[model samples]
Target: MENKIHFQYLIDGDDFTRAGEASSDIKSKLKMMNINPDAVRRVAIAMYEGEINMIIHADGGTIDVDVYPDKLTMVLKDTGPGIPDIDKAMEEGYSTAPDNIVSLGFGAGMGLPNMKRASDEMEISSVVGQGTTVTMTVLF
Candidate 1:
């Protein structure tokens, strides 16, 4: 069997203080495993973006990470309002975040863009009034 390490995290959407905690933990683990710094950085950035999106858009969600010898995979899922237009959402600086969220120094509309840039591969799937799921991978 292929060697792999897996982790799952439950994001608390209502708690801004806990935001990025999951990503931070994963970063540390990757570093400890002697993963390349570039790959670790990419994973951290992508995963952090996903976490913030879940907190800002979805009420709460789950993140799953799988670490393999050659790459890292991250999946984020939330049952909040789904993206109405994936194309528009993919555009930089286009955000549906409310004023209050923007006031908190988030919702700058860079989350998805940044996540995509950081990961080697990224995919998004959503259902209106249901939720959104994002999968990202970074090659080591």
Candidate 2:
């Protein structure tokens, strides 16, 4: 198998139904690559959370993934109402989502926490009116 592979996914804004598609596809690819189950699940869960966040908070975004022998790296970039306070957003059970989103079984305030828990490292950068970018890495 190749030592590395690259993939990109475009998230559709406000499309909660399709939010996890990219992560699902990535999981399949990892399975085909014969990667460890734990590694694949970590990557999938982290990426899925990021994907949903991009849709819910950032309108839409692009996900770039680099699959390697011993690690997985994902970059999620989006242009929307950027985070006003990253520290607050990172706190568990903190969410700025509207009531409607909360009704859909999402926006449970678990996205960031889940992503952080699933990845070895995660970095998020944002500007109030500009945009946000989240980078996550999981070690196999």
Candidate 3:
């Protein structure tokens, strides 16, 4: 079996019912590969959060995942309005989601903070009008 694997998934912006499918698939694959439960949980949670963020804020996006013997990497790219303040965005309770979004059970504003806490390292590149890309790595 290969010690490394790379996978990419497209997040459909219009499908609220299918938001976490990619993360679920990855979790299943990691389990079949015998990855630790804790590791799989972290990956799933962080990636799921990113996916929801893309759906809620970006209008849709892409997720790339690299699985290695000792680390896992995820990159989420979106085309929606980019974050104006990364610093504020990182704060646990700071969120700009609309009331409509909150009514749907998301937008608690814990996406970035939770992703950072779940991964070993995280980087964000965003432009106000261009887009946002988040790269996160978890060490095994």
Candidate 4:
């Protein structure tokens, strides 16, 4: 484990207040570790998007983060109603968020797109009635 740090967080469904907690914590840690500011910003944005998705769509889930000298990786997993169409979901402004969520000023359909744009690489796996797992990485 040469210069590697790992962390795990549990997200509460419908908890808009806590949606960005994990990402904020990670950002603080990264800054304390003297990580590149650009990389830290990317990680925070991507992770925060994932957290918001879990709260709105997945009804809660877990996020795992691994930080290393050369890169950082994040894995977000949720057991909520899985995505039926990944390709369509990838399209910007294509969101399945409920009306109530939209009313709260969230779920603008940009979560996944922003996450992908912030990360060096991203992968998503989902099962219709099972769950969704998103993995993202940013290189320093």
Every candidate's lDDT: 0.93, 0.90, 0.91, 0.93
Cand. 3 TM to true fold: 0.95
Off by over 4 Å in 3: 1-3
Instruction: Write down the RMSD of all candidates, one decimal each.
Output: 0.9, 1.8, 1.7, 1.0
* TM-score of every model versus the real structure: 0.97, 0.95, 0.95, 0.96
| lDDT score, candidate 1, position 73 | 90
Clashes of each: 0, 0, 0, 0
Ranking by lDDT: 1, 4, 3, 2
Candidate 1 least-lDDT 10 residues: 100-109
Ranking by TM-score: 1, 4, 3, 2
Residue 85 lDDT, candidate 3, scale 0-100: 95
lDDT head-to-head 2 vs 4, winner: 4
**Alpha-carbon error at 59 in model 3, in Å?**
1.1
Candidate 2, pairs of clashing residues = none
Candidate 1 per-residue lDDT, tens place, 72-105, comes to 9999999999999999999999999998888888
lDDT of 3 by residue, 13-86 (tens): 98878999999999999999888889899999899999999998988899999999888999999988999999
Candidate of highest TM-score: 1
